[model samples]
Target: MKDIYLLSGFLGSGKTSLLSHLIEQLKAEGLKPAVIMNELGKLPFDSKSVDEDVPIKEMLEGCICCTGAEKMEAQLQMLLEGEEFDVLLIETTGAAHPVEAMDAVLSPYFASRLNMKGIITVADCKRWIDRDKMTPQTRMLFMEQIKHAHLIVANKVDLLSDNEIALVTLQIQGLNNHAPIIQTSNAKLPLKMITNLEATYSSQEIQQAAIGKQLSLSSRLHTFTEPVNKDEFEKWVKELPDTIYRMKGYVPLKGHKNPFLFQYAYGMVQWLPEYIKMNPQIVIIGDQVESIAIIGSAQND
Candidate 1:
């Protein structure tokens, strides 16, 4: 059976960064690795970060654990039929609950061919502490992501002091006592830590655990054909409606040759200069985004 690993975490917890690093390491070891990416909106941004050599099946417009499961299964079957891979990595949306995702993966159709390796949840040290201040629904979704993890990674540790890190560790451990915790900045970790994981929960137990709760997020995909002025775009993104919790995409600046990768969680924005060529588009997730005005006169698909 092929090993299927799930990299789950909150938005801006660095799941995509960790996934990219792991994929590269897997390639170096001569292992064939395929990726199944889940995003909350139609336009996929995480897929662009991965290397072209690895095969990817992107589940967009919904989370794999809930509304997107049917499409995800079909994609997995297609990938299995098209190529042979030593392992499969599924990077779920930040909104996905680990137990619910586990239930979907452990379903009968995929159970025979795929092995439920483990769930590695990435947690941001600073963000973990701020969970209490978030909305009730957001807090529940965040808690569910950590509650059933096989491994808990307190990522972005560099931002916190030793004392802060210790407290965050205690908090995460309090919620998940069985899993081992690792500290890292930028989601950097040794490859062996991922490949050597043991399953903490069985499929039967996971199904029993998944009572089937849904996220209350509304998502939209925005596309822009023309290059935009960087400054204006940044301001627009940062000042988005309070309801928008997450936004990510590739944007081509008006005067720049290369495109910029933008990630926004809450009101904070992270920009990275990327070399890959791609169309300018963004996927945004929020509570009610139908009335929000996105920059560049973009169309929400």
Candidate 2:
């Protein structure tokens, strides 16, 4: 049974950067670590930032708190018993609630074996404190990440002022009295602190989730199907605005001879080559996507 560290934070909060640093440092101390990455969108961008040697598993297209988490126990149990690693580091989606995520990991199968070491929430000190007061999307993402972490990391400190930094720290700490907050430029911290920090996510959100376990795992499976005249298919995706969160799949597009592949995360779009090389396939993950529109005549079977 290994100790699992749940690394969660808002988008661009530096969780990846911090985890990269931790991986580098841990190798020096002779610790073998594996990672479970949950992607909010279809594009697997974070994998590029990780080390080449560490084993990585990707959970695509959903928030850990909602549906994708239902698979956590089975997958983790398999990893532990199969890989026999000393440590497990979970990189949750930027929109995750630490408590909810932890609860997902602690389901009956894993609770008996693995112990949760802590919750590390990476906060964009500047964004958390000063990025537009209103949320851009319907999802209450920002608040969820901030509300339930045991360790508050003030990432992207370089973007803030000395005054802004101080105020942000005070406000976050005040909001989360139990958490030990640390300020960092890019999720940087003493490696030892991550491994040894004796903290866990304790919040009403998790308790409430536990009470509604049966209902919480409903949106577990997400599947999209669409068939467009190859030409129109291209237009459909191009017409889609950045507001959509994730979009991806081996989709047939309009006007293209071969199937054109693409994936995007928050307006960051990547169109893969028709030939399979370097993760070639079409995928895009975003907020507002119309399945019926795209899957019009395509036979999923």
**For this target, which candidate reaches the highest lDDT against the unseen true structure?**
1
Error of 2 at 147 (Å): 2.9
How many residue pairs clash in all the candidates, one count each?
0, 27
TM-score of each: 0.66, 0.63
Number of the top TM-score candidate: 1
Residue ranges of candidate 1 with Cα displaced over 4 Å: 199-301
Count of backbone collisions within predicted model 1: 0
Residue 193, candidate 1: Cα error in Å is 1.0
Ten contiguous residues with the weakest lDDT in model 1: 205-214
Q: Which window of ten consecutive residues has the lowest lDDT sum in model 2? A: 212-221
- As a whole number from 0 to 100, the lDDT of residue 242 in candidate 2 is 50
lDDT of 2 by residue, 1-301 (tens): 5777789877777889988988888788888888888888899899788887887777888877678756675578678777756778899987676656765665433443455566788888777766567566513556556655656788888888899888888888767665677889868888766655542222321111111111111101112233346455556656766544444444444554444455444455566547532221232222222222333433321
In model 2, the runs with Cα more than 4 Å from the true position are 136-140, 199-301
| Candidate 1 Cα lDDT to native | 0.74
